[model samples]
Target chain A: MTTTAPARPAAGRSRRPSGRRAARWPAWRAFLLLTLPMVAGLFVFKYVAIGWGFLLSFNDARGTIALGDWNGLDNYRRLLGDPAFTRSLVTILLFTLFIVPVTFALSLGLAVLVNRLRRGRALFRTTFFIPAAVSYVVGALVWKMSLFSGTPSGVANSLAYLLGHDDAIGWVAAVDPPLYWIVLVTVRLWLQTGFYMILFLAGIQQIPAQLYEAARVDGAESEGRLFRHITWPMLRNTSVAVVLLLIINAFQAFDEFYNILASNLSGLGRADGRTPLIYLFQTALGEQNYGAGSAGAFVVTMLIVVFTLLQGRFAGFGRTAEEEG
Target chain B: MRRRHLGSYVAVIVFAVPFLLPFYLLIRNALMSKRELGSLDWHWWPETISFQGFADAFGNDAVPLAHALWNSALIATISAPLSTLLASMAGYALARIPVAASKPVFFFIIATMMVPGAATFIPTFVVVGSLGGVNTLWGLIVPGLFSAFAVLLFRGFYLRFPRELEDAGRVDGLGHLGLYGRLALPNSGALFASLGILSFIEHWNAFLWPLVIGQDPEFWTVQVALSTNLNQQAVNLPALFAGALVAILPLVALFLIAQRWIVRGVLLTGIKG
Candidate 1:
């Protein structure tokens, strides 16, 4: 393969003086150089800092920014006993349960319908995907100001009135009784469903058409046969990946909640909505409690790790080398 | 058969309303003058449309949006191609090299996807601040510029590419660099474009990190400025909508330009491992 092989010396011998190993040296050096910045950034920003944050949760308020003296599990004890933390956990869980299925089903439905379209599929795809291109900040603003506005001038309330509801609802400000979470759920679905629909569409296209043709010819009904034999089984793997991702993403839901509902309680969701990440943010940046934020972060990191492991166990995420083979 | 098609159209229209209504309202409101905007009956179109809102948008002091646009464009241009190249190199190694640590490295990179950005916020802020990147474009670009997820996508595609091509390049006296740049690169344009657009959209719409890091109003991205402007006491819905429309226009344009790849990226679980 080498054009310059053995002119003065063999290529490997020429590359190394007295030959300890030339190829390995350059490859490792090049690889290290390419990865240095990312590794350093992740090490400092991601893992080590987070480990420090974890350590802070056990300590009392120390020198303003630095770690304080250790209180030995008192923070964990407090978090366990706090009813607000419990409510936050329950609220987020309920939000996930409602959001995941509705979104998955709607997105899957869109994918199947659009995929079935022999004409103008591109138009439908473009129309459906515009929301994804919309900024989360903008989308959340629209939801807050117009769509779910509690006044008659608000779009959602107008529509509700047309639909026979007597009252204009303060959808975003419904925190004390907890309807604000529903607004949070609706805003997320608006922003994300298009993105996931594209995923489901991808999964559907990979499915062979012959199975459906055979089913039709063999006299199976359209809806029943498609649901029972074809669509259900074919989309299994994609469904798992999507569901696990949604669950993790739901816990990470912040921007929409922050942008839209942040003001509803005077920015207290940084305290209340308190998805572990939000809690971490409030503690770290909002309250300037970097140590506790880091502590809260590590706890969330542990939760993310456990969930990912469970997802890998069940969904076979990131297929193993054996599976690849 | 006609009935079935009709039913399909009905279903699509009905289903698509929830998706389209918000955008429709945004556009409609953006066109209305502030006086007309208060009307309770919001429909698909306004009887009288004006650019007063857009004019007002131009008049506001919510961070020189033109400069932010330029910053976003420059960052997207630099970061997308650079990240693609970086991801491609690492992906090539992961895909082609049989080093003992290759799989382990891949897994480790993928595992960081689970690391919530919030956890890294303060530390990254401190690091960026120490590097004198705070209030600079570099602050925004540094953290997000290289994505592990993009590497996974590139690796997935590269692994599927026939190795014979690389072997042929090697046989022709090409170094690993030449083989990567010349042989592997041209063929992977769609994947690269897809990843580039995805990364650009993310950076373009990046809010929290940029909000924290870009403390200088001079460096604020459009998304950050829009959020700040809209949060003011006298919330001007019309001008706000206009700004929102302007802010999202680039993304919509990019998506349209790369519609095919965007669809491909989406349908292929272009995101997942």
Candidate 2:
């Protein structure tokens, strides 16, 4: 909390000749001391490991990271040829398409509403944002075991009963109706929408109050027109960044899918619901087919980059904040 | 004017209900007794508010919450601060310190931002495995030591950092290292705490890595422990819910204490990225 500057020491230290030597400690040496560990660790953990994964993908090595036997395009070919992997890739694509827009709209809408509040902005923000603190595992457990549980005693079923639907619907297990998506989508919406809402709130706050006054003077009679001409256009960068992060997040969707659909009471039967990360998890870890798994890694990473680049191009992501204002 | 406020309040209520319902159910079910869990009638208040679920969970040996809590604390508390300190130093060096390789080094660190950890997680695990890091605390700690994101945040902060402070440090005959140790690090208390606390929560909540690597029960984090509870035979439904609530207790407390700072931190991560 303290923002004060460091106190000036007495003149005795500077007056000594030895103190001059300490001050003259080379910038190069300081650079080495500061960055060496971070750089080296990054090199080893991220770059080297990712590089090794690329290399490992080419090899016929099964159940081991040791090298020598090279399989070339076989791993890539295998993953692409397999319906499961392709389905995972497709699932993530559809998920991104489904989730990004819905979440984007929801968060922006929530931000606009919450920002409208004069009395309880913090209260509402905290109520929404509190879910963001919950882990997916815990969230999934609550969603599956309590709220969306198939039994008649569950929350959803109780609501349905009150609405005249006598039979309890198995929300997660019904593949024909694809009710699992509701469970998956709602839990994700609950957990993530709040964080993005906060971001949109920040972006909304940066729009000067005078802009609204100016628009009112210009005879902008309705909220819709004000939002369109002022708020929506002003939130371009924040929206782009939010979409980019959401796309990345959606692609990396394993935790909820696993806990909700895969782990607890059931095995993963629906290939359509399995995300790329879940597919990769099974390929590498479950089946111990690390090569195909490694191959899938590059594929997923490329999708994230391509989707982000495409969205960035559309949204004009590189504009300066001052230019946006 | 009154209508507008009321309309927004109603809209807020509409959003808040869906958001708040799960938490309410989680708490209610956690306190419900085992027999009550199976009751056909919906009990808004459990007939007998029972601690049986909690007792079953804590008293169960298969999924050990106590050990997992210790492991999670050790991993988060240690790695988060270490990562924050390193990020600050690297950030300071990039922004403030004059070095020939600053631009290239900064670019190199920035390049890694595009690659999500979820992508190369297995590969990273394989590397950690090769280095004998599997199932050990070192495995969890080492891979996450240097955060490029945190470093980027620090570099931004330091770029906008007032030059007079560094100049004053120089006037005091402080070396570059001394200036960093004394002036730069000390001045960044909020940044350190904000980033560190966020990272701490992430580490604590981390499931995938811990689940994959922690094959041995002794190495379980609370998440893995909770997941492990699912597959265990004769599932204690009430106990499972209780365990879920317990797992979130520390996080809930941390969040309540530092919610304002957390939002600011989230705002930074959102807009900056």
Best candidate, lDDT-wise?
Answer: 2
lDDT of 2 by residue, A15-82 (tens): 44664554434877998899999999999999889989999999886888887789999999988999
lDDT of each: 0.71, 0.85
- CAPRI level of candidate 1: acceptable
**lDDT digits (tens) for residues B62-166 of candidate 2:** 788788878988998898899999999999988776545777788788789989878879789878989998889888778878789999999889877887988
| Candidate 2 residue B50 C-alpha distance from true site, Å | 0.5
After superposing candidate 2, which stretches have Cα over 4 Å from the reference?
A1-25, A263-269, A317-324
DockQ values of all predictions: 0.38, 0.51
Please report the candidate that would top DockQ against the real structure: 2
Each prediction's TM-score against the native? 0.87, 0.94
The parts of candidate 1 lying over 4 Å away from their true place are A1-20, A55-74, A78-83, A175-178, A263-274, A311-325, B40-44, B62-64, B97-108, B129-132, B268-271
CAPRI docking class of candidate 2: medium
